[model samples]
Target: MQVKTFSGASSQEVLAQIKAELGADAVILSNRTYRKNGELCHEIMAGVERPAQQGGAGMPVSAGAAPAPSSGAGWSEWHKDWMRVKEQLFMLMKPAIRMERLTPRQRVALEYLQREGVSDGVSIALYNMLAARPGASVLESLAGIVPIRSWGAAAWPQRVHLFAGPYGNGKTTAALRCALRLRKEKPEMQIAFINTDCLRGNGRLTLRHWAELSDFGYLEAADAESMRKALALTAEADAVFIDTPGMTPERNLAQWQHEMGIDEQPHATHLVMCPFYDGVQMQALLHRYAADGDTSLVWTKLDEAVCYGALVNVAHEARLPISAISYGPELKQSLSPATEPMIWRLIFKRQLPIQSGE
Candidate 1:
């Protein structure tokens, strides 16, 4: 007997074809239903009495592959196991289904983010969550995902405030601005400046100039011993602001930190950056600097940045809150407390807040 296979959308359709080809003497060797690329198909294998040569199974019994015979009682056991696997595959693929439901605007927004150097995983995750929310606009969906902490969320902790970041990231400027803001918020508060960035050509002189003008106490520490001496002066002030050299390597930065006696001192460390936000290295920067919620993110020199996606991407990846933002060179007007709307304006619109006149 030769074995032949038939397939159709339903069993009756396939059975009719089987009867016409093999007559009533045909025996159904196997039958099963399954989904192929999300479409359901039914297949049947039948045996007919005929003198057949070996390997004649290559003949097109029907469209697609000819079904082979089952080992024992047919495909009952095989089908059961297959169905279980199919269900599990369907479950795991549900997220892909959700991805297919993204709106055109959301897709456009995703593309925009990716083009602006946002990581693929972060972009996909944000869009998937947005797609799941019905009636949610892209701007509205994005407004919820980007993390920002208002500058004023927590009052200036009466502790040593330290700023750390790579060179030219505006660490000194940020530390000075933070101190000035704190002083402005509380007029009677006494603030002192400690500069650990002894290597930079003009960092100490620049900070000292400002310190002399403001008449706030100032100390320059070149090594661990100097750092200790500078920190001791913090005892006489309401709050001490610590600024480290941006030129130092990561290991040296850690060494300076260790020598500075932060473990023994009540201190708040802020990771400063000039919005160099993009890619795996950017994420690594966040990981290396912004260790936890306690370590605030300080973004400096927004006036020089044309794209803010890096900041949003870093914030999303690190799950770190932006504590402050510096907009320009002027100390009085440049620094502002970070806020959701401010970050949203920069992110979605790619536009900073309009100055009063322009």
Candidate 2:
């Protein structure tokens, strides 16, 4: 890995420099703000993995020799090692967690969270936050890790939106719910639905039915050329929602988008997921659906989940804000723009985000 330090007047400026020099794959090792020469400055240490034989385009010299492993494989191995090390470190630090400083209620809450399947890292962070401030509640400490950026025009100003996730995760439903919510809020806004899941009969029919009934424009795109024409047709609309197909284990969302020419547009991709998956499955799904640029998490099937600990774990791991959440079997009135109160209530009380008389 090649590491370098960048300093600038602002963190955004320093980050831009890092991305420009190290490419988008660069990871920030550390960042700090300090005063230099009577002026406030931001400094960050960023590192990027060195490419293997840059000019060779990852190809082996000899035709008979085996091809080198890809960078993704290398990173996967590194991530596994890092997770093992983190678990070991957390075990070592477990004894040092000063639980005595917390109130009885706070301690009970933390213990409950542990039983609910929250990760060790999040527990330690909550412990530190509560111990550092005597008056801080467990919910407040959790809010620091689980950020909420509600879904709407205000939160997501991008004209193009894409929904992606694993099979049976409710990607199509979430996209439709979001569009309906946006339409309810602004009746004059022009909305369009572009269905890319041509292989799925149910999803395609659902999207087409809702689009036509609601008087919203709809199009289907199964390839790069079709996707281009679909986008061009919806260019005049105020908001364009693209419903993507569920990804298989062998496929990657970022690479697929790049191949389909969807990456060329300014858009936000919401990763719609259910909270019932185990830790390993959730992590695998996150890795498979990972993409560049604007992205957020949209947790679905909240009504079916027993324990919501995976939500906190995913939020902590991905560091992406929660945009919306969907529950119940019905699409209408089942989704809600994620809020801190709603999430905390669901996590701590097992309460659904259902409105009165719903």
Best by TM-score: 2
Question: In model 1, where do residues sit more than 4 Å from their true spots?
Answer: 1-100, 103-111, 137-144, 153-155, 247-255, 290-293, 354-358
Model 1 lDDT per residue over 198-228, tens place: 7777877889998878768888877777778
Model 1's TM-score against the true structure? 0.66
* lDDT by residue (tens digit), candidate 2, 157-190: 9999999998788888889899999999899999
| Span of 10 residues, lowest total lDDT, candidate 2 | 58-67
Clashes of each: 0, 0
- Compared with the true structure, the alpha-carbon lDDT of candidate 2 equals 0.81
Q: Give the residue spans of candidate 2 off by over 4 A.
A: 1-70, 74-82, 355-358
lDDT of each: 0.65, 0.81
Q: What is the C-alpha RMSD of each candidate to the true structure, in Å?
A: 18.0, 11.2
